[model samples]
Target: MSREAAEYALRARADERDRISGDLLDLESHTTYQVLKGASLRGSTEQRWTATQESLTTLWQLNDAYRAVLRRAEQIRASRARPGAEQLAALTELLAGSSVILRAAAKPVERRSLIPQTDLRLTLDEAVTRMNAAFREVTSALNDIDAVWNRVLPRLDGADADLSKIHDLESELGETAGLTAEESELARLRTAAVEDPLGATVEPHLDRLTRLLASSRAELDLAITVKREFAARRENLVAALDLVRAAESEARLAHGAVVVKIALPPQAQPRSRVGALAGELDALDVSADPWVLRAKRLARLEDDARKAAEQARTTAKALYGLIGRRDELRGRLGACEAMAARKGLAEDPAVSESFARAHALLWNAPCDLTKAAAAVENYQRAIHGGK
Candidate 1:
């Protein structure tokens, strides 16, 4: 193909590439926005299923747009009649870069349903990396085209001037019959050269090039739109995730409060074992000298000691009840932990630690109720610490 034809073809390819890129980008942005909306809805106090559906729809649309762009890019790159060797190579590189981005964007959707916040973040990171790479490739291609035009413009202008000069010379010679046959042939040759320097084949290629450039520009615009939407959606998703975490924390604290309140005994009850023990020790009226105590007083002291001992048994029963309640709370906490784990929410270290503390509290013996109470207190502190 002629040089003009080749240049036009390259332009066309560039335009098409830009157009598809724009479309893909727009879709991506929309998808990301939807994702954020869904995440926010999930984190909200009210569970709105509509947001999830919107997210799914956005993702599907983004994927479809991405595929369409890829196919068109490939088609333009492979169109032998229009794309020259250098343009083809550039197009191929662009395709490769875009494929990487497409894969990155696709991965999050595939695993979003199954993964935790951390995994989702990883997938997003990959997608962003791929997107940046694709953008870089497109930027590079645009720069290369600009550079080529810079060099070619002056040369094309000079050629046009030369053609005009040759045409003027030919017109001047046509008025002279004294010119030789060789001169006449030379004039004819000059006319032909001026009229078709690159030949008729260049026109169609130039037209194709123009079309390709327009299409590429359109695609690029779409790509930009998609990217913006994606960014917004990502931000929304992050906010939603943070809110969900806060709610989980609040729930844990509420649960801990319930556990503490239930475990504590009412303060209005009669003398507990410890209280009775103190009373018994206080009532023992030992004289300044222990030998001076009366027998009646000593008998009274012995009876009080026996009564304190009996109170200790009642205290033990009350302690058992407290321990039982503590055990039940621990069991409930364990169940919550298991449920969270099954739902992929157990990645948080605080949740794991709380689960462990609850288990320890649950398994403690009733005889060591005092120690158990202290442990339960410590467990409460740990749970608070986690928050």
Candidate 2:
């Protein structure tokens, strides 16, 4: 190379070396790299991190050698106001020749022989290439481990906090019956996350534990409320039972009226569980039973009582509907008779007979609604001038 070309090359390489040195400082001081360096990793993270450390060591050694070459070139240039041919030649060799020596003495036991080991040497450009590859390897490993810790560790902390809340609720309620499995699961997840986060599956387990904790809190709250307010709740349930009894009595009276006034009425709905529910409520040994058990029992009893009252009210409405139909037929029959009188068919034998049968069927006790409906139609036809 010519003198002028060597001078330009030396200046470019020196600048590149400075940039690489700044990048190395940034990598060493990175937060994730620091965390991985101090962490005791296992599994995939351990294997990858071990390889990355080897690459990082080699990268630093390469940088040192690169700096040495630039330093030699700078010294040669600074030696004279205008370097001669020999100085330029030496500068070209340092900037562009095989000037960086890479130590390769470490070898496997099987690869060792009696021959002396030789160091591998490369030019400044080749040294930078090798260092770039090593830097990439180290950065990729740090990022991978950082991603796993970022994704799993925060979730583990959140799960631990939830478990603490559940324990507090259990203490407040003075119960310790159902959380053993959850506690064991939480411990296992935390251990795996800390020791082998690279391979741990934490989200699904955390979600399930969250749901279980919510259910446990709800149950604990229910038990506490039942313990504190059982008296007021029992009173409300008793009043519901009284309403059921009232509906049952009203249904029975309507059924009797329908039986006397209408023919072929449907049978009355059977008495519901009001008596059984009242007995169950009275038999509840609140002082003896656990609040959880009492809560379940009270819930069942209240539901049953509410259903019984609704059924009785429905039955009463249906029975009264049958009596209302009979009254409706009577009114229609009377209106047909008045229309017959207006048309001068009141004296007609066939019209009078039809009106009589319809009136008797409608006004008489145990009224046959089907026959009364047919008779009313006949009377109406007669009033419309049908023979």
Candidate 3:
């Protein structure tokens, strides 16, 4: 109401109007809002989107009405360099009065109605409050829809990729049965995601499908690899069997030599499963058998054959180790005798007796290693006069 107050109000309102205009433009051009505007939606999303559109329409209408009022006030203030009391009164009425008409009453088309439909109007402040409420509604709608889209779209894409992998794996194995159910489930989930994303429960179903797809892929991959590598695996098995036989032969020869040369050597470990493993390998007919079945059999056969080979090799090395120990003792006994001779103790009765006893144990068939080692220790001590 005063001239100065009206002038100040006009300036403040101008700034508010500009700010509201900019915000409105930003909201309209927002990416999520634009996406919702053009999307074909269903379920709760469609319902919320419809309500949000009405709120957005009301928000723009309110902004336009608010701007019209501010423009009117600005026009009145600009009419005079220094407005009179009449101009100030008009500015006050436009700025603070119920000047924004939201809706006009419809006139009677056929007959006059007894009750009058009232016009919805608000003051400048009330218009802004209503616009803010509508803005919140619209923005909330955008957020909800954006959240659903963000959560479900990426999951759908991942499921689709898994489906593609299943298809590829199946193609490699030439096995395509039992996959239709998974494909149908994916299609159902995709439909729910695109249409009723607000209520779509996709993650649990997608997780189950993903696990199934992964298992199927693993099985198919194994079958494909087994089929392609069957010949190589068979060759590896044969090589392993040959190694087993060679190692077994070497162990037998060493066993015979030890039996003749040592008094009581430990018996060689018996050969294991060579015939049985070879029979199993021969029974695997890759041409007529399912690769899955053949793969299981081949894997068992390879394991058995390799273990047999390793055992035979270990046996041979042990038998050879016994012979090496005997030779080493003999060499040590000779060295002790040479040392006795160097000291002029070879003819010493006690020294000579220790040397002969140790020599007999080191040289005789079926040598008693425990006594031989004791005799050598006695000879070593006799050279030093039992020190």
All candidates' TM-scores?
A: 0.18, 0.69, 0.61
268-330 per-residue lDDT for model 1 (tens digits) = 133323344334334533333222132234344445545544454444455445646666666
Minimum summed lDDT over a 10-residue window in model 1 is located at 40-49
Taking the tens digit of each residue's C-alpha lDDT, what string does model 3 give over 325-387? 888888988898899889999899999999988998888887777788888898899998897
lDDT of 2 by residue, 1-387 (tens): 787898799779978988998899999899988877788778766787889998998998999888988888899899998999899889878887999998775778998988878887999989999999999999887777678778877877777777787677678767763788888998888777766666777778878887887777677778788878888998999899999999888887877767877775345545667778888987885346766677788888888888898988898888788788888888888788787788888999988898889988888888888898998988898888775
**Candidate 1 — which residues are off by over 4 angstroms?**
1-295, 302-306, 318-322, 338-344, 347-349, 364-386
| Best of the candidates, lDDT | 2
The per-prediction CA RMSD against the true structure, in angstroms, equals 40.6, 6.0, 8.3
The true-versus-predicted C-alpha distance at residue 234 of model 1, in Å, is: 86
Which candidate, 1 or 2, would have the higher lDDT against the true structure?
2
Q: Given candidate 2, what's the lDDT at residue 189?
A: 82
Higher-ranked by TM-score: 1 or 3: 3
Q: What C-alpha lDDT do the candidate models reach, one value each?
A: 0.44, 0.82, 0.81
